[model samples]
Target: MSTVEVLASVDIVALRMAPEAQHLQVLLHRREREPHAGQWALPGVIVNGRTPDTSLEAAAERALREKTQVVPCYMEQVGTEGNAFRDPRGWSLSTYYLALLEPGQVVEGEQLAFFDLDSVLARKVLLPFDHNLLVELARERLAAKTVYSSLPLYLLAEKFTVLDALGAVQACLGQAVNNTSLRKRLERLRERGWVRDTGEKNQPRLGRPQQLYQHTPQGGRAFMFERSLLPEGV
Candidate 1:
């Protein structure tokens, strides 16, 4: 009797959050060949070796460089999916990684744009293989993280207003937050000294002048570390 050997593969998915539009965007590359040719799909590479020391992080970095020529600001492992029929060719297990990047960092590819999660979910676009499920999982992870962490900062520019920051958070969660509750959360963040008012007030058309703010270096690191420790499903 001959024994069948299982093959292992690693695939990285980069998720970019845009708060203003309140969307979680995944980078999809257009395929130039058969098996969903001209279709959009996540950037990934196949890993093969006896000792699988190959990290998804490295694969993600390499994919970014090769596809978009950009380095992401944040990366984290989400989970693994292994189904005998997941791949068309053979039995494979794919390890997925999530990444966050600032706007304008990546070179746009054919049909590249940050898409709104709500729109994607509503329209039910056919994703390549099981990639849609992977996206849903990543979206839930990011939305839950943004509430008490500084993950949203990656979506904003160096200097931004409180409203801008709050909008980003709301977008990730796919809903509008109560003004009072949101303000309280911001106050708590301010108390922790994670953010600073930039001292530049912007006068809008029909409202009180709003003060701008920026994330402090100390605050940024603290938020990142705190987020890393958040319990699963947080």
Candidate 2:
């Protein structure tokens, strides 16, 4: 019988804006060495060790910095996956995190590129070591969590207009939201303390300036959505 060896690792699902491509893109890195050389995969790292002060979340953050050099505006652990055949090296337990980066937050790396969601999901691009599973899990988690939580705020700029907030949410959902329903939802969110007025204004190229708002630091904990604002399959 083969001996079962366990290893711990972190896989980051990093999302960023790609305006030129006209869609939100996920960051993927091409491997240079063995096991999956020359193939694209999610940026990740092995957990070398743990200390009294270091935790799994900390390990994930460090791995992200060491590999991708991008510090996300917001990050949270979504789930953990372990399968006997998932890793050829051995049995591996991978902690998955969903991370969001603003437009200018990432510095382009040689081995990294922001890929459109469709391209990544189409399976035409090669990925190994269950990396694609991590991406799919992250996508579903983000969409589901955003339905009931204020998690989409992480994708927005420091201060944003209502349209900007809607756009961010729409990007994650990959569908257009009902304007009236969204307006009502935002109003309710504000009343529930999920968002607050920033006392600032955003001047568009043509339209009159609109008031701006920022997410409350602790807003995500304040409420749970009664119904999903997104489409059924999202």
Candidate 3:
């Protein structure tokens, strides 16, 4: 007669761009209670049936809102992990999500911080309770999505130039995308109304002005295509 595990939680890999789009960052928070209290961890919240989360997403949203006080521009459930040893108190399960914020999205809550994803992934920073593993898994999924979906677009600000979009994708994938292929994809996205050319260009101090673009009314969510900025699966 094993005891039924009561600990079920949702962890969010709330990702965003650093100022100037220098790096991709993930949101973390310091725990307040025992069992890894005071340790920086991915934003998480225990499932409380009384709060009556209408769905798993609702619970994930609550964790992001309550723990970090910021709503991501895009969010998706990545996967789940469960085991007896992950949590010290008892057997527990965690449903983790990948949430993306626009560039320069500010954190408005106390004790919430954003760390460079590279640092976390490289073990320069450590997290508690399988959180480090969760981040690694989420990044893998995010990178795959970046290859074939508009997932990286959520990392941009409301208005961005082609170069800006490339920077975002590069940050997520840790590789440079072809400027030509990216332009082609944007054209396709524009045709589908997922993106709109703002009919404006940003003047740079050094070079030519770059055209600006933004999401259209129907483009609040990430959209997928048969390919990315290249030929199918290139």
Candidate 4:
């Protein structure tokens, strides 16, 4: 009898978002073949060599280029899955990465589209492997990060309105934000000059004119935080 040795492999999973007023839309691709054929899955690729640089992060960049022809604005490893039986072909370990990109920044290939996170949650879409769990974990992390960190900036345009900025944050939290509290948060940001009013007002339908704003050049650095794992076994 011949014994076949199963080798460990690394893969990358990326979650890209499209900012919307009520929810942060996530990008998902329909797999064309097993192990999750015809199911929704995150964009990913396998690492070819055993090196630290040829890691999950590198795989994610390659996947993005192949799938959408664009590099992610920001990406970080979120966690890893090393279940022995996770892949039907062999033993595989996947390192998941979370990426944030602006809407329409990438030209998606076939079988890819932006999906509303709320709709996915409501419909309970069955995802490939443990991806459904991964999405949930990513959502929780994004919500917490948006509260005090600069993660939300990735979703906004280079210049945006205060309402638009707040809307993006609310979408991440998936809840209504108190007007007073939101104002206070903006005030703190303003005092530091991390954000400033652009002195332009947008006249949208059925509302008084609202002023526009933009994050300062230093806002990106100010809002960034060291990426950390979700939790052990999460």
Listed per model in order, the count of residue pairs whose N, CA or C atoms clash below 3 Å is: 2, 0, 0, 0
Q: What TM-score does model 4 achieve against the real structure?
A: 0.79
Model 1 per-residue lDDT tens digits across residues 1-234:
112655554455565655445466667667666567787766666665743346666766666666556566677778888776766655667777777776554556565544555655554665676777777777787776776677766666667777777676776677666666556655666777877777798888898988877766462342743332223553
The lDDT per prediction is 0.65, 0.76, 0.86, 0.63
Query: Pick by lDDT: which candidate is best?
Result: 3
Whole-model lDDT, model 1: 0.65
TM-score of 2: 0.84
Q: Tell me each candidate's RMSD, in Å, in order.
A: 4.5, 3.1, 2.1, 5.2
In model 4, pairs of residues that clash are none
**For residues 166-217, what per-residue lDDT tens digits would candidate 2 score against the true structure?**
7777777777878777777777878977778878898889999988987775
Superior by TM-score: candidate 1 or candidate 2: 2
Error of 1 at 75 (Å): 1.9
**Cα TM-score per model:** 0.79, 0.84, 0.93, 0.79
| Candidate 3 residue-wise lDDT, 25-119, digit = tens | 98899999979999999988888667768888999999987898898888889999999888888888899999998777887656888899999
* Tens-digit lDDT string for candidate 4 (1-234): 113544343333333446444456667777877777877777666564553445555667777766656566566667776665666676666667667767545554577866677666555666666666666767777777776675665667766766766676777777666666556666666777777878888888888988777766362343643432122332
Candidate 1: residue pairs that collide:
19-168, 22-171
